[model samples]
Target: MDGLGFTVDQMAEAERRGRLFGLAGDVLQWSGPPIHTVQSAADELGLSAEEVARVWALLGLTVTGPDVAALSQADVDALATWVALKAVVGQDGAYGLLRVVGTAMARLAEAESTMIRAGMPDIQMTHTHDELATAQAYRAIAEFVPGSGT
Candidate 1:
């Protein structure tokens, strides 16, 4: 057993699964390393940090402090979209819509994760255990489902 009390096989399996998840994140385009802090994003968009945090909270995401570099390009783009939406719908309506969409998307993401996990074959059964092959299989399954991950 390793230091964590996991067997070698368990560790290998965990590593393989982590790689697959990383590949999936890459394919999704929204999992890039964060490059913008809340303050930076607010400065770029000409909004106060509080407003940015509020929008993020409305989208079902945890609101980080202004200095945390937790916002990726996709996040900033989404925030920009929210700003535009708020312009049209006004603050109250925008918040309502964001809350509803965030909840629905969260549910959809959960369903998609379940479906993908179900669809993947057991690594031991395949006897391949190759990262490339596993990643291709994961990508195929992820793309096959028409959900938020796609």
Candidate 2:
């Protein structure tokens, strides 16, 4: 037994969790690029710290600090997309969309966590341990949506 007194099964399960956590980026399709700190993202995007903070909050998260590399490449890319969208939708409209999407995603995440905690398969609502690719998951969602016109 290890010093922590964890059984062999427990140790193996812990390692499995660690590996899955590491692959979360690939699961989420966050393969655009590496990330930067909040301050660096703000300066690079020509946005203010307050503005960046707001975006972080809208995504149902809080930035620990300006120097924390907590944001991902997709996060920065979304900021750039926001800038372009703001020109067309205006700030209020953009924030509205962000709020809706963020809240929806948060609920989905909670449901997923609950399903996992129950030791049930949640991916595509199947009972297999198959890992899902981000693109495949997106397509599944699109296909499931009624009147999505896809």
Candidate 3:
């Protein structure tokens, strides 16, 4: 029962229960000031609607709005964290990070299976030597620009 050790069964159960976010519960406790709208929340902290959407999906929450006008602050903060992590992946261009995020996300059971989905066309094209370096650059911009709060 040590804080750091979990049996495979325990980990599997956690994954089944969508407890990946709760794994970081100490850091994720609701200690910040309240936020009411998604856009304002994103604006206050610097995030994008797309980033927010992905985070909400990860946290077992759903956003129901036609636009930025209908978003909650809590959702925004969580989205910010997701954006940060995603930004890191893009910055490094290390597929390992992408795999880690995808694995963690898989445990959350929130999003679709990324492996089944295709990689970015740019990545695919570059992977085929169509434009490899540009593929990395394209990935960095597409993912980080929205997530980095820039």
Candidate 4:
């Protein structure tokens, strides 16, 4: 599957990298598999679908349709946090805080990824594209980073 100026080999390499990195998802505290749809998450959290979508959009996430199972446990926790904050600060205040936090977190993630990529060569000096080596390097790096407790 080649598109967007990426040759088939490039796409294949990306897929390999993604598969290797996916093994580090738990260590990285990345979201788990999708466990809820937008409507389900809203219903479980005692929120309207629109409210959930709005919060997601404010956090720089794509707002999926009501029936799409695009939300994970981490996503649900975030929505729950939004609900709690909204109760204390009202919707607008919660939105403002979410916007600030989201932007900051996004920037931090970009910086971290850049740093990690820069360090990967030293981390796995011999087997650059070896999946197991790459995954191990990622897990080691993630272990050193602080957890977000999401």
RMSD of each: 8.1, 9.7, 16.9, 7.8
Clashing pairs in 2: none
lDDT of 1 by residue, 1-150 (tens): 143244566456546766532344244444455789888989987899888888788778874567878888878887788889889989899899989988987887788667666766632225446665665566566555446443
Full ranking by TM-score: 4, 1, 2, 3
The CA lDDT of each predicted structure is 0.68, 0.62, 0.45, 0.71
Q: Write the per-residue lDDT of candidate 4 for residues 12-121, one digit (tens) a residue.
A: 65467555333453335547667788899999999888888888888887845778787998889978977987999997898899899889878887887788777676
Say which prediction, candidate 1 or candidate 3, comes out ahead on TM-score.
1
Kindly report which residue stretches of model 2 are placed more than 4 angstroms away from their true locations once superposed. Answer: 1-34, 120-150
Q: Write the per-residue lDDT of candidate 2 for residues 57-107, one digit (tens) a residue.
A: 997877768787667777788788987898898999999988988898788
Model 4: how far is 44 from its true place, Å?
A: 1.3
| Order of candidate numbers by lDDT, starting with the best | 4, 1, 2, 3
For model 1 the TM-score comes to 0.62
Give all TM-scores, in the order shown. 0.62, 0.58, 0.30, 0.67
Worst 10 residues of 3 by lDDT: 21-30
User: Candidate 1 at residue 68, lDDT?
Assistant: 77
